[model samples]
Target: MAGEITETGELYSPYVGLVYTFNLIVGTGALTMPKAFAAAGWLVSLVLLVFLGFMSFVTTTFVVEAMAAANAQLRWRRLQNPKEEEDDDSSTASDSDVLQDNYGQAEKLPILSVQRRGSPNLFEITDRVEMGQMASMFFNKVGVNLFYFCIIIYLYGDLAIYAAAVPFSLMQVTCSAASNDSCLVEADSKYNDTDVCWGPVRRVDAYRLYLAVFTLLLGPFTFFDVQKTKYLQILTSLMRWVAFATMIVLALGRIGRGHGEGHPPLADLSGVRNLFGVCVYSFMCQHSLPSLLTPVASKRHLTRLVLLDYALVLTFYSLLSFTAIFCFRGDSLLDMYTLNFARCDVVGLAAVRLFLGLFPVFTISTNFPIIAVTLRNNWKALFHREGGTYPWAVDRVVFPAMALVPPVLVAFCTHDLESLVGITGAYAGTGIQYVIPAFLVYHCRRDTQLALGPGALNKHRSPFHHTFWVASVLLWALFCCFFVTANIVLSETQL
Candidate 1:
């Protein structure tokens, strides 16, 4: 399929198939979905996953419909000016020429203007509404940024804490059970003692925090700004594979080993539920929409690809979740990855630890380009030209900005891993992922197409479409409330 061309040489490639689809399947969800499952039971969690999948499906449908509507507007516009090379020849006919040929006089012909040319399609407008609504619902950029920052801080910080803590925790358990000058003590040396620092930081916590902040910087500073970043796209795709493999290996290891000393088996129903949510959210990858949209051959092709890609992603998540739950039976799904980290046998633990540690690094690398892209698109616009070049301004300004901001806030936020994950989940998840998409769909369907002429314009929306708008809006509202109250407030056993 050929791409749609703009007036300039730039081709509209929004919908590049599997690569974009892969990005959508990975991200923050991959980082913390296990936590969501840990909070809820497996049986209940699976059911919730089904519901979330349905919502995601509906949201995807809404996106497709909006894209279609926009394409239709473009088609309508093309018909009005048939000779314009920008028009997609397949969808539009030469209405003006046909009128002139048939009616003999173009002035006498009665042109039917069902819709206007160049109007914002329901989807584009809805996308704006959704973004604005998300920013607003979270209250403001400062609050939203703070909430997200806390999450990155905690997740990264905890990754460090746990890396060191796992070995120490095991040691404490071993020493308390063993006699004085025991054989286990003899086996422990500098080589095996997890405390050996390779850098200035003596503590693993600082190392991990730095790593987290480093990874966290990627998302905001460099993802956009390019017409396309094929190398970065390939890197993201590789991370997708790595995340999948690591998720499987760690999940299985934890599940099979079951539990550590004094800890219950890793099959708690609450944890299972949380895991399911995390699986759906993590594997779904909603944040990569813009990238996925690029490289689409046609609007029709893009729709088919999205539906298929989402279905496959859902299947992958379900299988992974099921395997993890079945293997580790008990209330131990909470902190699933940590269980894996803790359970790594001494013989192979070093390699396993190194592999597990790479997750945060990979996550950080993946997000850097994404953040850069976002800044270039949104913030840079205030100063720079819409499509102007700014010779590594993003690197100089945005990269440094991301590096400094999160750690500073982390210093203030207090690094409790669970609390940070929950708070970020509540604030960012509620408004950004769930609320906004639903709102955009609702607004797009209900709002009339902006008319450029003067006539009654209520014909585009039907009752069925209106119902979709209402149902989606209502569903998102419920999720928003649940996420905010349950996850953000830090109540007993809720998040």
Candidate 2:
């Protein structure tokens, strides 16, 4: 009741803004980045990576800020439809006590259409509000929600890779308990049955089963609502920090163990290129936009925020890659920080092992919620009714169900870890990180009014600046379309 209101009378916060930005940008990709590095080769990949990061940062900065500005300047009527306006007029029985100038009665309701129930339906209040209208709206726009499904598929693929190899790695360690040969080596191979010991259960199906288990895990996760998954958000954040720490320690361990070029043969340009794509995908947390704007810093503060964010991300990525190259060279590099650290007997092994062992649990926890929410919201919007508002409850019911359904239907589609990474690289990678923001940038850059903050109606700018932005917009659009198409084709062909 006492917060800053937008033109539509919605509350805005700066805390949510920062959280949304940070969360949107980080995820499971952090765990798999090493694998990407292994494929791309450090030298060639790093250069391209730095450039990509810079482009993404700049583009994202311009687009998100501009959207905030545009939303602010629009009149309340422009934001919502006639149905919403009518709903507002009927509700808000407290209109007689208009104490706040910021409060716009007509704009209080969102740009949504609800079902016409009984007369009481117009004013019925429930403890839990339905917010699925937007979800339904989203699907209508994006065709089949394939992009959202892709995330669940990717996560399932990761689980499959882990299941296929982790147990085998453990078996090797137990069999050769006293030997120096790494248990992980046997598991890392594309082929599963290289028996270092006489009695190790090495078979092709074993690896296949591992892949199947992972896929099975993934199916259910994709079936639910993304907005409702709270545990997923927490676990992912925890995993991020854990992955970051483990990567550094593992690199040091590899270095200490005398692994040298400091990288494996497979960690080439192809591998690193793949990793770059994964990093971009994992770090994307755009869904947290509502939460990120919870804080209230001035428009002038955004430049500093962008600068700090880029610096932190770039520094972490560069150091992590360098450490990876320094510690494991050639075909010996691991796919994840956990895989790397699992080979060592260092003090950090306890934390690393726990993370590795429990990661699948945490990973599967969120995938379903994300998918269901996205779908549910899209469904509501398309139907022109209110969707479920509480994402957490929706996720609780939907996440597990989604997780279980996929594997049952597909017989747990199996894929290798690297193959999974490649799929994501070709699909979600190009669209979410590179394409969407680029399109938004191109669309918004022409109007200088967009460049100004929410108070743009009162701001001033030169006509020449608008021309400059127009040229800039065209350049970026061309680049985005070209690269998106290229990346898509190249990824599938592995070119």
Candidate 3:
């Protein structure tokens, strides 16, 4: 389970944790946000985005609190079972020995009574409890399975979005180049797969070909353990910074020159549903909390650290979206904003235009295999039996195959990036980002009360500790589901 404390050395400062969290929360979702803002109206989008960022920050606290509780519980169980400690020589004995010694001194103490005493060191965030591990600790079989199901769905959506995005970008740039040397900056100029890119080859065929090439190039990495090297991450981070800075500066310059053509409505009710989904997706970091928080050297200001990160991210999102909406007309903004600057005229330099156009291609291609392997490992963990080993073929091939196929097929059927992002974020992203953390915190608090007695205090408890906050998060998630579903149904009927 991912939530169990592993002995990975803590090497990062809190600042590094802040950087990682920032990077994790801002990804492909952020790129789609300006278009969402354009559609929803900037004022409405601003209010909703801030509210969503706060909600995400609240849930992140919930996850970290649960993580501390999970660690305390694991330590308590080990203290109660001294014989198991004696049997496992490879275990880290010093910490367990100190805990056992404390328990032995108060031999007549009730189980976990030491924790109930509110020992300052008892609930330390030393252990790495993955989200799945925390689910297993606090949830029953049914609840645990639900957790896995939500996560699996979210990861699948993530893969599908990545699969579609790269090929779509490639097709857009290739077709635009083949059709004319001049860039297509006009709002009404849209291309489809049925449009010709080369001699007798439609854009749709070209998309499939690119998708195939993408799969062929990156798919095999899923079969092996894919570790993202430090250099690779650093390189991608640099590209990300360059691409984002260029877009923002370009948009701001256009707006400053008074050439802005945008006149987005004050409120577009039709776009509100998708805007909610995009915001949820953009602020998501809850699923990766355990991995992110575990390596931090200190926990004293963990919540404050998270708060600052979200503050910076929200400001960045606002600046990016506002500039975009003011610079480009709502109808002209592409789903991927980088494409708007891909024109040689818009950007002037061919190299810069090419870089902007291929930005998604460079970043998403790196992520595809890593995400695919993660999905594969999650599948193995979900159905895994105690002390059971999978067959060679099943372990090596079957899981990776299952993880890679469906998303590619989805990419084949449609390249509607906005709809894909909206639907995925609305449903599974809602589950992982909002519902799961709320429930995990609720259950963890209850379990802590039962084990450590009502008087026990968890040092890492969230600032939003009231029961009302838990109910509020769940209620918000429920409302989002109903709202998104109604919008889908109404759209279908109108169609």
Candidate 4:
């Protein structure tokens, strides 16, 4: 991909990028949100959800702003050493011919072109830098390692959740007692490991069996390079929209027919811990912003496009969760909201029930290998030296195993998707979502100004450019950490 494409009519427009970003953020978290919302109570959930969404948006701009800074930094280094310019960086803009090779050898020029308030802007965002590369650029070795640790932990939690959920859905739908069309079983929340799935097999055994199949099927992709086929993304996107629409309409339809069973409290502090994590998990799109935003040919209105996407996502989450908590009782809600409708009675049509039951299978099955591959690559990156290559065995076997084993082990131990999301989002998600970006933007700002002189402006800088916002983000992350730790300690003590 071209590193810099400031002019229009190139790859894709900002509008298309908006849709891709929306899809990225609105994944598994949305499916798990209603249960958290119900437990937390509507008033508290709504207020926290809105605040979390706003904070997420703020950090998203930080990611974008950092991306532009990464570009500028790469471009400056390239101009300094034109020979080794394209060695690691991609900011080899064709405009390097503007100055002679020894131009800045004696007395330095502006690291990047100087930008005086209304002078024609020349400090173009000339490269696409991944977050890891950005961390390496701005952070010390310890900070870089911390960033990788947070990301790896978050992805592991994601894989474990997926590993548990797909099989759990299969276990729910295939149980002979539950699946028989003759019996009108209500979507019950009392399911457990001891429940009978088939004549002799218990639900727990069936779940493990399906988990084995899922691992055998998708786990191999971690060992090889898996490029997401265009058709696969399209198919999954279609099924996802269909699944979400069906759930929302079914919930709305049930509430309309005087079958509404929900009566959640307006405020409840007991569930706030899970609710905060759920909201953070739901609004996550910061890490992948580089891949999504870089290919957009024109970034003039990129921030506006992102704003529109977040607004739409916030509205959609509110609709999905609000309808959900009101249409189903808090006590009866499942960890996976979609599972609540995976029954003949809840959804009138047999086809719809089948589709809803297998929705995670379709969408998440496709996503597993991609995430596995990504995690595997990240593990390799964390250990890589400046001029080093791993042996074939370590590269192929060790890295993939490192990526695949821990999450599977976690899944084997527990299928509690709620706690999995809560723990992951509250801690690792805090670093990636709040802490990392705040520090990245803050450091990148200092580095950029030092290089380009104070007058050098990054046109794509975040609106929350003030130092106060960065400090506030850091403080909020600290509060979440303390609050979640206290709750966990209290619960354990009680137990």
Candidate 5:
């Protein structure tokens, strides 16, 4: 059952692939965008969001191009070394004899005929070549290790964000009534862990308790191979659409009624750093391309499909954020935008309020175990030795334990989802989204030139195929890193 669940079979259509990509990219990050937009001002957020969306789409093509190149290389190597399978047995001929035989056969075949028929789809990005596998194939030892480290850090941040979001939502919803607080209450008012939730328990204590309960419930799944079933994905995706649509309609209605309160600045440079992180995080789908794209059939129009997907995603984000900024006062918007509509008076229904409040608990909780398992698998792959296997205890226990513990500890210390998303997206997220893709495409192009001659071309190469594009991506990544680092240092010094 587990094997079936975790199998990487190519059974999905391109449309399904698009939906998966959409869902994956539009996770917890979207929930934070409203706050980032409010802080940074609508115009700055709008420009940055569109630019980042296009940039992310560019990198997506880079990864797909790399996947195709990796596949072609794999096919070429197999064709060149056809005797590898038989070499294990003593009856096989020597390497020189095999090579001579292959050469003789190649001499008999026409070059164009071999190119046309020998491996017709050699460059098809159909195989499940994961990012890590591609890194191992294209990069040196140091690059491979760095790729793993960046991905691992991003996944850790993902886990910690998930760990904190659910319990925080639960604490908010459950404690709101007890504290006699309305959702419309000032957002700038900070809630402390020291504030009482029950008789003697503070809200922070309730938050910790909920985190403990959340860990106990979902943490065990990391110790085993757990695949999110298709049904769960469908349900969550459906719920996401419903929740987002509801908020947008409600906000638009409020704005139409002339109750809108937002009066944002043109551009706020102070907030650009965090907004950059939030936008980058919101558009992240590069790391999961293998899982999403491998199953996609009829990928001849994949680039177009991806472009359309990004168009829809960008439009959706704009609508969500614009409605948020216009409908509620900038100061009243919650970090999780859903909470803004969680009050009965605001949404005008007890059931809707409950549903909106518990939305994160359902959606984020469903993703936690899956992300944890992915992190665990990546960890195993990072230190994985060829032709070797781990003992059952280490395989089952240690990797998952390592994956689960640190993120939980981070969650224990802070529940600031904004800063968490910002730091994670700014640092590790930038590497995975921008830097790694640039390097991967560059190396893949160079490798293809060497292997297939200069005239050889990747059919799926990104439209931004110029050397300048790769250099631009790297330079932009460097700028973001320096900008974020300076911001962090300034923030620390101020504190």
Candidate 6:
């Protein structure tokens, strides 16, 4: 029971947990936000970002509450059926059996005949139950399938964006200024795909070449185990923070020097559609909350911790984005915001220019394998049969290929990182971040009340416990989908 896979992550202090959660929330999404901010204008982007951040926070509480409910359910089952015995053989499956199926027998803790003198809270989140396992416990078969479907779509989008971003960054840096002495720096000019990168090689061709290299380097890891080691995490986090600081300082310096090229409109509804997706993606730490929050030695102030982290992240995003929009024209902002500094005219130091240009490559390279392996494993779980092992080829070749192929092909056809991020966040992000959590908390609360007698209350229940909150989340998701879809249709018709 102690060595169970479900509880494998290392425990840490509450502050360390705070840092991990913050790092998780702010990643590639933050890097793309400046372009979104510029296009959407200052006031509209600010209002939407604040609203969405609050919504994301509400759902984060929902996930935490569900986790407590999941633990409470497990505890009740353990009390009711200690030895994994079936209470009713005639029934298709007992609740205890279902819990065991979702969270293996290794999770079956030995019940204490008498309660300890000072026991923990009734629904203390002691066990680290994953989102998928929680889904299996609380959702019907179809709901379970839908859960996996949304996650797969989200991961596919994530990989496609990554595939396009790294190669694009490499091309931008090498061709623009980092390695090319004769590189021309046009004021506020945005390059096209047909532009030459090196000699006769086109920018698009250079991107593809680098994409192949990235695939060859990281693709093999999907076929094998690639642990995200502690050292690797530390190195990547360090690089990310440093890069963010450098970009912010550079932008602020340019604005201070009165060399700002930006004169953005106060409002631009045409850009609102993409900005919605970008904001949603930027605040996406909900999916990973179980692993992120479970290890804290104390969760007494967990909600407060999450709120503080969100506030800090929101402020940081504003500084980074506002500085960028003021320092550079909207037309000049690249999909990956850091690439804007690659030109010698924008950033004087060659080393700083190269570092900013290649920042995505360095950080994204480390994350690509971890995400690929996770997607591959998710595929295996989705199709896994009870009491059966996969054939060698299916496990090794088919599953990995299924996980890796679609995204690569999408990246091949279009290197439009903004559209990739927008589409991914708009559809799949809404499902995972809003719709899923709403249903999860709603069902989980009912399951907990049924499992632990009618009187038993979840100690960690969300502050927004009223049924109204769940309904509101679903309604918001519907509105976002309608708005984004209508915007897309209108744009196509205008074109």
lDDT, candidate 5, 1-495, per-residue tens: 111222346366778778888888888999999989989999999999998898899899999999898778766655766675234222222211221111100111111112222243778775566676677667877898798889889989999999999988888777776665555222333466787777888888999999999999999999876677879988999999999999999899989989787877788877888888888999999887877877776788999989989999999999999999988887777778888877665677767777888899999998898888878877776776545678999988999999999999999999988889998999999999999999999998877766766666677889999999999888988998899899889988999
User: How high is the CA lDDT of each candidate model?
Assistant: 0.42, 0.44, 0.82, 0.79, 0.80, 0.81
How many clashing pairs per prediction, in order?
A: 50, 75, 5, 0, 1, 0
lDDT by residue for model 4 (1-495), tens: 333444322367677788789998999989889999998899999999889998999999998888887777666666567776654332222212111110000111234444323211434544455677678777877998888888889889889989988987787777833546542235665677987877788988998899989999999999997767768987988889989998999999999998888999998888998888878888888888876787777788878989999999999999999999999999988888877887566777777777887788889999898888878877876776645778999999999999998988888788888888888899989999999999999988887777666777888888889999999999999999899989889888989
Off by over 4 Å in 2: 1-20, 73-75, 78-190, 193-232, 253-276, 294-300, 345-354, 357-361, 372-414, 441-495
Model 6 vs. true fold: TM:
0.91
lDDT of 2 by residue, 442-467 (tens): 43333322333323331112122344
Model 5, residue 301: distance off in Å is 1.6
TM-score for each candidate, following the candidate numbering:
0.59, 0.62, 0.92, 0.91, 0.89, 0.91
Which portions of model 3 miss their true places by more than 4 Å?
Answer: 1-6, 82-115, 182-189
**Compared with the true structure, what per-residue lDDT tens digits does model 1 show for residues 1-495?**
345563212344434455456565644454455445445555566676666666565555554444334334334544567775244332123322211111100111122345543343422311111222222232244543443343333333323222322333333323322332322221222222234333433334443455454445433343333233557656756755775676576556655676322222334453442343344345333433532453354443555566677666667666665555554433444332333332334224444444453444444444444333333333332233323556676645764455345543453344233444444444444443455455444544332244233332322222235565546656764764575565334546654
Q: Which structure is stronger by TM-score: 1 or 2? A: 2
lDDT, candidate 1, residue 88? 32
Which lDDT tens digits does candidate 6 get at residues 387-467?
567899998899889978888888888888888888889999999999999999998877665555456666677889999
lDDT, ranked from best to worst:
3, 6, 5, 4, 2, 1
Cα error of candidate 2 at position 441, Å: 4.7
**Pairs that clash in candidate 5:** 193-204
Cα deviation at 6, candidate 5, in Å, is 15
How well is each residue in 35-88 modelled by candidate 3, as lDDT tens digits? 899888878999999999999999999999998987777666667676763553
Worst 10 residues of 1 by lDDT: 99-108
